[model samples]
Target chain A: MNLLVDAFAWIFDPAHQAGANGIPTRLVQHLGISLLVLLVASAIAIPVGYLIGHTGKGRTLAVSLTGGFRSLPTLGLLIILALWLGVGLEAPLIALIVLAVPPILAGAYSGFEAVDRRTIDAARAVGMTEWQIVSKVEVPLGLPLLIGGLRSGTLQIIATATLADYVGAGGLGHFIFVGQKSNDYPQMLAGSLLVIALALLSEGIFALLQKLVVPRGVVANQSTDVRRPSSRRVAVVGFPTEERK
Target chain B: MNWVIENLPLIGQRTLEHLALSIPPIVLSFVLSVPIGWLANRYRWSRGVLLTVLGLLYAIPSLPLFVVLPIILGTGLRDSVNVIVALTLYGIALMVRTTADALGSVSSDVTQSATAMGFSPWTRFWRVDLPLAGPVLLAGIRVVAVSTVSLVTVGAVLGIKSLGLLFTDGLQRNIVAEVATGMVATIALALVIDFALVLAGRMLMPWTRTVSPKRERRALPVDEAVTA
Candidate 1:
């Protein structure tokens, strides 16, 4: 309780807000960098995933391989990229994008895969073109999972992007690295709280966005979300939850 | 290749440290998560709350978590315990939900039949539920293993000095090989474990490996249409 109070005080302190190290400034950097990674990842992964899902060729292999990206240590990659690319935004930005792609890709293609085979067959029966079926039927139906993937990717980037500090890319991690060096636990905790808050807020916003975008008829019920929960997004990289009939 | 061969000893020691740092947390979290998962599965009311809490814990960024953990545990930043505990939290965060899902995946009919036979609840879970849930649970474990392996590298920042130390040191010295080596080794660890788990899951659940008649039905029709 006391710790929480102190942590809040640290954030709200005017003394802390006037410098290069101000919380507001750092939060913008954090959100900026994280949003950049999210946009790039979504742009790259979603279309590729959709194509794989539509073609149903190389889908499994692509997803599993992307899942491999999840296990590459972000810190290690950040340092390595920074070393090679030099200590600008390139290192952390590239690393976070790579980190963000897998789940989005998995969510996308899997969402495509998750659509009922019968639905595609029915669309074909109605004389819909392949692209029409994809755009009109598959993507709309796959939107929840696709958004779920974006949600997971966004969550992952925001959470891990703190490592940007390691390469001096400059984010909320600035407070943390500096605080930890100076043994400022309150300051560190405050930064962590902000990170957690951002992640949860994004998660909440995405969930609500998913609810708004997904058609009432497409998802049978909310229970489906639970059973799949972004298709084991939190667990395995390509960890597809076996779909319940 | 020359660099790797020349520095095999340094790599080997770091790899060992990496293993030591990653494995215990996974094993420990798996041990702890089983009961918690069971409780979540058995009690409907607790399921949402339980998994949500774990998810939130996982959402906490690792660096912050790493820095904050020592304070929570009253340990030093350099303590190996900090890494272990942080990784364990992540492991439990992931595995608990999957564990519950695995248990839930057990068909109710199987449990009902087991119940009809007068097996104790304990016997039902151990004999029927757990074994049936093994494949899914194993799938989840593979994820946890890979994730933990990657996350253990984050420990390098706080000076726990696993293979990730190579990455950090390599960065500082502008040595690409060391960073590349560390990244490769860490990724290799994850892939090997992932593949091994797949094979092990197949071995444990042989039925899943063989083509099911239901799948064969779909495949034949899809194949015929493609050919025609």
Candidate 2:
């Protein structure tokens, strides 16, 4: 009980608020690494996912690839990479990029996959070129799922980035580690509270983005299908179909 | 390589320890999630709230959970039960929505027919809805199994024993082989469990064998592990 109070006190303490290892500093490091990883991962994954979805090839490969990567324990990978690459952001960056790729890739292709085939066929019948169809039709329709993927990817990277300190890359996890090393439970709790808050905040932002990204017309059409809400978006994270409701 | 060969018993022991720590949460969470999933599915209003809360529960990272749980639960810092409890929470969070989706996937007509035949809701769920939802539930549980096995390694950082012990110990000792062995063992354990789940699914739900490959592919997705 008192520990919870101390944790809140630690977070609010003015002295703890302004240093190299301050809460603000660690938060930036965490978000910075997460953003960089998301950007790089999206760049690499989005194109390949688009191609696969656009062509309807290599889905089995992508699924297997994601399953394989997903099973590779993150912490183990982080430590091994740190050992091989030497202690720095480089190792953690690579490891996190790997972690971030699968969801983005799944999101990219699946977003394209979610667009109605009849819609694409109509676009073709209207004399649209392949590129025009892709840029104009598929991308917009797929944007919500793509953003959904990004949202999941963003949440994951934020959560995992806390472990950057394990490889000597500083983030909020540093507090958890430092506290663990010295038995400072208050600091450890404070760090965890911050990470949870950040994750929830990001989840909220992405949820809003997902809502806003839906084509207004599609939203109108989807109203009839409200009872079956989750059927359209592939259950990427087992998000309840009713969650959107 | 020699280091791996010499540490065969140690590796095997760690693998055993990993399974011991992992299987309970997978089973417990699956059992617990089904009812909650049923509740979420049965009540339209509760679905959003239940799923959202569970989703947020999962977003909290594992390591922090491991450290923070002792403070919350008043367990020892290195307690294995803490890892089990934390993993179960994660498993339930991930599985609940999947379970709801699985139950939702059941055809309404089939349930109505069963009802017309005089089966009560309880009997209908066990004999009809659950079996019909079997394939998806199996996929969800398979995901839970693989991820739980892989995640058990994280506990080693707090000095709990599992294959992850190899990574921490190897790093401190500067022995790459030990860490590599740990990675292989963890993946191998996950694969074995995943394969076993598939086989079990086949045996338990033989009707799924006739389901189209295309339909089967749609049933599983990458998001389960992503959220984990």
Candidate 3:
């Protein structure tokens, strides 16, 4: 389609190729913010999630709080944060971090829930230290779900990081918003394509990361379990299993 | 705070608008995704492709999708259908796998026994499978409900009316109170819907009430809202 051609053309145009506000600069800014938010969210969520999962005392908070967090409007939060904190990076950064937290948090503790009880019981029978057991046994077994949380959080931040433009922060959203304002359909499409590409690329990279770190036994199970490659993780999230016996 | 207190009626109206724009897509998608979910669960071959496609669709950003919808549907830029249709697409993407998982969670042996007892397929689904799958399906629905309510605010980006207008209007006008109110209202609405679904689940399946909300939620988790 001509629209498609125009979009590609706009992306490749030389005039748009080199500058402070150029596409490449925006792309780096976008990815930088997304990566920073993902790290911060992981830092805050992973340890707490691991503790809660290990203790099994906070499943209620995990379930209900994430449900609440999932629904907080990101754009609105950006607006609110910008109003209170001044129109700058801090607002969008905070807003994006809040958006990124719930999944990472859920993935962690729930991933612990997903751990095979026999595995943990085996660790205890062998007199493994509590910390050693968590680090050596639980976390590895729970890595898939923890990674699932990361996958979810990263994708969300990537999508949302675009909204930074609204708060006077620079990102690909600037292109999209400006394109929308000027009725530059090609540029809008170009920005959308760029964003979608980045998101898909991130997913591929994470999938590779998941494969690299997943324990061998789980990796074997992953190939067989087709519904959710992480069926073990799903079983832990809240499905009831009936005893056939 | 004083302005928000004096403007209670406007707040109520905007909240209602928010719910109206949000709730329909959840119900509409739930009704439609059930059969699609059923098919996905029933067909082993299609399951992988189905979930992967949906997951990819889920990855599409909400804002761009909002802008793209009008162009794809040949609708006017301002039509509320744009928002409804976009939310519905997202809802279906999120719920189909969850519904499939809920049905999949129903043990095969149970369904087999019902079949052996001479129940027809449709009756078996209605009597055996659907009831057993109810808790998980309902949990997924609640997630969708919470997500939809929150997502409705994004519709304001295109000037689609909802509580999100307060955030936009407030920010543009530098009224932090209005923005704060919208934030509080949106979060509150999400919690209320989540609890309402919990109550509905308990009432529909009285056995669940024995477990407190804490334990019950634990037994049946929901974050396809966030995860998807």
Query: Which lDDT tens digits does candidate 3 get at residues B102-156?
Result: 8887876688779999999999998898888898888889888888888888877
Where does candidate 2 stray beyond 4 Å? Answer: A223-245, B210-228
Q: Write the per-residue lDDT of candidate 2 for residues A158-194, one digit (tens) a residue.
A: 8678887877899899998899899998998899888
Candidate 1 chain A vs. true chain A: TM-score? 0.87
Q: Residue A35 of candidate 3: its Cα lDDT?
A: 87
| 10 residues in a row with least lDDT, candidate 2 chain B | B219-228
TM-score per candidate, in order? 0.87, 0.91, 0.87
In candidate 1, which residue pairs get closer than 3 Å at backbone N, Cα or C atoms, i.e. clash? Answer: none
Which residue pairs overlap in candidate 3's backbone? none
TM-score of 2: 0.91
Displacement of the residue B164 alpha carbon in candidate 2, Å: 0.6
Better of 2 and 3 by lDDT: 2
Q: What would the DockQ be for model 1?
A: 0.41
List runs of model 1 lying over 4 Å from the truth.
A1-6, A221-245, B195-228
Best by lDDT: 2
- Candidate with the larger DockQ of 1 and 2: 1
Question: TM-score (chain B) for model 3?
Answer: 0.89
Q: Tell how far residue A71 is off in model 3, in angstroms.
A: 2.5
Candidate 1 lDDT, tens digit per residue, B85-109?
Answer: 9889989999899888888877676
